[model samples]
Target chain A: MSTTATAIDNKKGLWRGGVSPFKASYGKLMMWFFLLSDAFTFSTLLVTYAFIRWSAPAYKGEASDFVFSTEYWPIPEKVYEAFPGFHGVELPLVFVGLMTFILIMSSVTMVLAVEAGHRMDRKSVVKWMLWTIIGGIAFLGCQAWEWTHFINGTEAGTIGDVVKNGLWINNYEIHGANLTFNQYGPPAFAALFFFITGFHGFHVFSGVVINVIIFFNSATGMYERRGHYEMIEKVGLYWHFVDLVWVFVFTFFYLI
Target chain B: MEQVSNVVVQPADRKKIWGIWKVALILFIVTSIEYVFAFTMSKGMLLNVIFVTLTIVKATYIVSEFMHLGHEIKSLMYSIILPMLFIVWLIVSLVNIEGAAIKGARGTQDFTGSNGATEQVDEGH
Candidate 1:
């Protein structure tokens, strides 16, 4: 009877309140919840983008029909062709691919940093954190270049087509994209581009900031003083979340 | 996790390094395949299916592996992931209804107009 009671007590303790899934702490669980909420927001935006893209007409009017002729949508390949130096050549999807690769590499470094943190190795954590920050900076630089190119746009429309008011009249004058006008096909395309990428870029910017802070803390041996490097792992969760979002964004915007 | 007097910090999980590398490798390979499809496949049902499937695969892998959710208690994992099915349902139904509305509008709306076309609203005017 004593042994049975002890066994019941142990089981109660183990299953108390509820099984803590994976023994995850409150912070990690909350992080998952936060990520889940953010997922919904992102998915809505992307799904709407698809809905708009699918419903909208590809080419608005005919080239021969001068009065009605205006192309509203630019093909993804055509818009994203030129690389930074090779502006003259049409190299589609290459630059975005590079950006994606950089982000992925950063994620790898972050994982390594976390791995090092698990071992309580401060030097390895700092090194990996520094590399991860550099990768983040590089990705942001590439995005800046991309945004500039997108805003400036390329020459669009036919020869006779001219800018009437802000709208492309006979011709679609390729200009920097904004709320009102841009040269890259439809205004919605540019608008959606700005909204989606802008949001993601903001996340990256904040991630970098958090990374820098943690990097400084790790350098100063803050986690070491606490006898644990859980901070690194926490920030790591955030970093990986950022990378995961990027994966989705890359697919929605660039690839498909 | 609650702390106790005897609670000792465990050594770093060394084996996770290998797992991370494998997941990263898989993600990279899948992305490469996506690029291949982008250049080769014309836009169609098959292309869409491939993109969605690969994207889901990549996402699930990232969530499970990188986030370490897969190692978590089964109930916790289920609690988190099961709700996402509703999100998928929401997206599908909304897109379907909205798409049907817009595609139907194509019949009534004359897109070949010379006026400055804004969004759908400006198009009509």
Candidate 2:
């Protein structure tokens, strides 16, 4: 048989074997579809955020009208304004900036790892993957800190002064606690914030773990033996998806 | 694997990965803009509009550059972006409806409470 005939025969045999029908590789295609679905999920959450904010009565107070007080949707700056120490200075949204920076940096490292994979540079691939993992961990740390600050409620002693009302207003008392429902905007807002951001944070944590494993595998030449590092690209897709969702969260939840 | 055609199969052109420093620079610039806006702009409808616009721009850069989605096929891009837009529309409509209901409820509650008390006082007198 000629070379062309032999190639055609092999193609026919493989087709008859009844393998997966996807035109692209299974991993890459799946990542694309997964990202598409995830995009929808995030959009729903953001939309829900908007709906709640709109439906909830808006208090006429400015963002800085209250400090460390749960009064009026908790002001993104007031809820997230911590930075290691420097307590009582009231720096709003500074920690969120740190979190955003960390995630973006991790994304940069992830892209570098994907590039190194394309170049088949095992050493660089491992190194960049490790860096990416570190960045992910750092982001998770920032998230944990933000969560702690939020759940602990800033200035616990003042809780008695707030009254329960639908409106989130400053100086309101809820159930004799200084933190009124009005001051905090609504309970649903805090609940959704925790759920959505916590879910994203969990994804980041998992991504870091997966990156660590890939880093080790690359370090030991496992993918070199397999002759491909497509895994890196797939993980990069997930990492990017996480970052993309954060953009929406920051825009709708924080900035808006 | 059909008969491997004799046509020239050019190697896929790999795009250059943006440098970390450049990515860092972009992040810094975006964050600085966010900070400046947060501090300089008072909270209101104008601030809300500007903040959301800037956020979308920053997000686009991150998605296109960091995620490398810019190199993807047109179909793939639409598959992602279109569904997201729909979700946004749905959420906005729902929120607006709820806002109207709450406003109505608050108005009714105030009217009934005051009217009921007045009727009872007139009967007592």
Candidate 3:
């Protein structure tokens, strides 16, 4: 007869009727689905890359080390050595390491943002979210720089007695990357590199855009009106998922 | 930082924040270990095992801590992780079959031009 009695009457069995199977909100469940699907897409790309590399003929340098090989799959270490600003320095994997650090730090900030959101602390959430967006943008910029350097190789090629494109040490054509030519090693290498990293970059870019929206909403006290910060937590889940995929991508594509 | 120290914050909340930071530190250390091994270790079964093992370790931490899956109900967690096993199956089967085919084809013919004349096992550069 009373409101409390009515509320208690509405309660159903744990496993049927109106109960949530996973104890997760509808939006959060949907986010998990999105992330799972995204995970499949990325893993497929990476595994296909592995399969293709497996299929390719081995390239061993005269020293027989894959690191300095001029043939076969170009050496992973040799091809990715160009650091930003210091043009000719042979700093292998340093740039990538820096990028990894950036992504990891961004992920950390995202969790912090979600933590702030839990307390209904609008200012803290905004601050942490802004840092995350900045980190994402910086990552995209770094990827652009990496792609530019890779497509327009610095490895010089020597023909007979003359040195053509003195820094052209890579296998693909100099200038930029494309469908047919990749200075790195095999055409497939550049293609996969482009497709995979580009896909991840696009995710980060979209995340930044969404972050801005949430940042705006949080600034305007939208969640405050709703009496919850679940939205921020949901987006935080997505952000961290992106970061997780990058860990796999970095390991498979670069570190391996 | 100062705001986090406000009197309104509970000690339990502070502990949770510190726990997150601890996991972050662990992630950093593991990644650094991966980097060091990448250069020092050669490509082989052992190295591959190490890399895969380390990757799983990193993934566990991320899923458990950052995603808060560690606190999730068993049904929810299993539903998310159990299905990913199929992907691993795909990786193993495809790489094995494809790699074998490539090796067979390679033995019968050489398409790498002059580099094809070199020995199968190369020394370091």
Candidate 4:
């Protein structure tokens, strides 16, 4: 009878308000909740993007026949084809692919740092954190370059039946994309591009700042003195969340 | 204070480290596949389906392995994931009906006049 009472007490103890039912540290649990909210925010953004893209009329004809026009949605491949140094050379998806690779590599490095932290290896954590920071900066640099290219309209030649002003005016030169107008297609395309990628970029920027702070904290043996490195794990979760969001952004924006 | 003391920090092991690299490798491979498809395949529903599926695959690996959610308690994991299902539902329903309504209202082909000759005037502009 005493054993039964104890078992009942044990089962009830989970909800007795003294124990953590989830078995997660308070900070970590709060971080997860924060991340969950963030996921909803990103979801709304991407869903809006998808809705807009879907509502736009699909481009018809061969991929090679695609030209900038108000009449149809622009082919993503044709619009995003310009390579930085190679300028006019059409290298579709390569640069964005490189950006994706950079973000993923940084994410891996962050995981390594967290892993090292688990072992209480402050030296390894600092080293890996440094690499993660470098990777984050590199990605931001590439995004900056890409944005510059986007703003500065490409060389103005009407490539095969490009339309302007809702009429096929002769000598219609292509202007770079802005929120007001997009030489690519509808103005909404450029607007969404700016909003979505800009928002994601801002997240990356803030993540790098936080990462730097944590890197210093680890390097100076703050966690070491505390006898734990849970801080790294929490920050690592944030870093990985950034990467996860990028995976979706890359797919919806570039690949699809 | 006692709850805080209960926080357990698992030490790193070789197997777990290997698992991280394996996930990274999978992500790299999936992205490469996406690139190949982007160039080779014609734009259509089939291609979009493929890309979306592959993207989910990549997202799963990142969330499960990199974020370490898969190793967490089942309730914690479900608490995070179950809410996201609403997002999926939102995408499926909203994008389908609203997107079609928008396309119908705007009628790009009808409004802009795809042919060079038709001087169709759009009053909304």
Interface DockQ of each model: 0.34, 0.25, 0.32, 0.42
Residue A251 lDDT in model 2? 66
Worst 10 residues of 2 chain B by lDDT: B116-125
Model 3 lDDT tens row, A15-106: 43465668888888889888888889888897888888777665533323333222356657667778999989978889998898898888
TM-score, candidate 3, is 0.85
Top candidate, metric TM-score: 4
* lDDT tens digits, residue span B48-82, model 2: 77777777777778777776667676666777678
Best by lDDT: 4
lDDT of 4 by residue, A82-181 (tens): 7778978889878888899999999999999988888777778999999999999999998888888887767762332334557655434557877766
Ten-residue segment with the worst summed lDDT in candidate 1 chain B?
Answer: B1-10
Task: Looking at model 2, give its docking quality level.
Answer: acceptable
Candidate 2: stretches off by over 4 Å: A1-24, A67-71, A156-185, B1-24, B96-125
Q: Residues A5-83, candidate 1: write the lDDT tens digits.
A: 6666556545463345457877788877887798888888888887876666654454234221223555576668779
lDDT comparing candidate 3 with the true structure: 0.75
In what order do the candidates fall by lDDT, top score first? 4, 1, 3, 2
Per candidate, chain B TM-score? 0.72, 0.61, 0.72, 0.77
Q: Of the candidates numbered 3 and 4, which has the greater lDDT value?
A: 4
Off by over 4 Å in 3: A1-11, A61-71, A155-176, B1-12, B106-116, B119-125
The Cα error of candidate 1 at residue B56, in Å, is 1.3
- B6-112 in candidate 4: lDDT tens per residue? 33545668897898899999999999999889888887779988998998899888888888898899999999999987787898677778887887787644323
Query: What TM-score does each of the candidates earn?
Result: 0.83, 0.77, 0.85, 0.87
